[model samples]
Target: MEEQAKQKLKNYVLWLLSRQEYSRRDLTFKLQKKEASPEYIESLLDWCESLNYIDETRYCEGFIRRHLAKNHGYARIKSEAGAKGIDKTLLAFQIEEMEIDWFQLARTAYIKKFSNITDTPDYKQKAKIVRYLMYRGFNYEQIEFAYTHNQS
Candidate 1:
């Protein structure tokens, strides 16, 4: 019975992976929700890893690519990755390795939203832009750089 259940879970996991890459934690939670035994889930995850079917680094790379294409800031990207159950250390390593220019991305995002600014913005306008950038997951330094360079 346990073997049958494990086979079912393995098939389900493969099907899920076919749709998208998932972090180990994401897979664990998903399997748990499906009533899979914790022991089976752990062993299954190990098997998946051994087979190279589940890899954190690969997942992170793909995730970063997709989000960066959407013009998300580093902060927002990191936050979203964390929410998806990626380890902070691994995420930091990937970010550093990728050499992502967060400030540049932030500037691009601001430009897309506001178009080109011909004159220096008023205090109120600057504040609104700052708030929007922050909400978009940029750190203070990245936001400042975007505002300074983009503002006329």
Candidate 2:
């Protein structure tokens, strides 16, 4: 490849990466959209990886941290990462590494979504909260303790 062509691809990759952390798959797709040649694209990607300009493992860890901070559940994160072409094994490992109180995450989301829920002692109200939590990717067993414990 000509030096000029290689530089342009590298520049595009650098610009795309400078915006935010991206999965390798995301970067590849974006570069392809730019019509970069297959050879330059592959070589450029390899160069970035070698230079540690795009570390997918670090990107995964950061993505997990940010997504969890947004109160997203394991299911949503798992599925989202899968869509990004992240391997199931890596997703599982990252989910395991979260090491967070998922109940608290669920509780916070529940409270935020239904602040008026606990004001009344209605079964229907409780059921709605339960359903909401489930929709947010929480397990019934995990949220059970929060529901019972919150009453006191």
Candidate 3:
């Protein structure tokens, strides 16, 4: 009966992985929700890792790429990845490997949102734009560059 349960858990994990990537913690949480035995879940997770069926680094890279496509800055991406149980060192390494220009991405996001406003904005409008950019996860430096250079 225990063997049968383990097989069922393994099948479920395989099916989940086939559909999409999942971090180790994410998979563990899913199995726990199904009330699987903790020992069985741990053993299966180890097996999966040994076979490279679940890789945290690969998951981090995909997560970063998807968020980047949405124009999210480094701070937001890192925070999201961390929440997903990804390692900070691994995520930072992946972001560095991508060689992303955050300032450029900030400018692009600003332009995409404010393309219609051609004239210089008043003080209140400037404050609003800055707040918008900050909420989009850009740091002050990137936001400043985007605000000043995007107009020209």
| Backbone N/Cα/C clashes per model | 0, 0, 0
> lDDT, candidate 2, residue 66?
82
Better of 1 and 2 by lDDT: 1
> Each prediction's TM-score against the native?
0.88, 0.86, 0.92
lDDT of 3 by residue, 66-147 (tens): 9989989988887888788788899889999999999999999889888876777678877888898888788999987887
Count of clashing pairs, candidate 3: 0
* RMSD score of candidate 2 (Å): 2.2
Top lDDT hit: 3
Candidates arranged by TM-score, highest first: 3, 1, 2
Ten contiguous residues with the weakest lDDT in model 2 = 143-152
Q: Tens-digit lDDT track for model 1 on 1-152?
A: 37777788899999999999988998999999999878888989999999999998999988888988888888888889878877889888988999989999988888888775656667987898888899888888897788778853
TM-score of 1: 0.88
Better of 2 and 3 by TM-score: 3
User: Which portions of model 2 miss their true places by more than 4 Å?
Assistant: 119-121
The all-Cα superposition gives candidate 3 an RMSD in Å to the true structure of 1.6
Rate residue 65 of model 3 by lDDT: 85
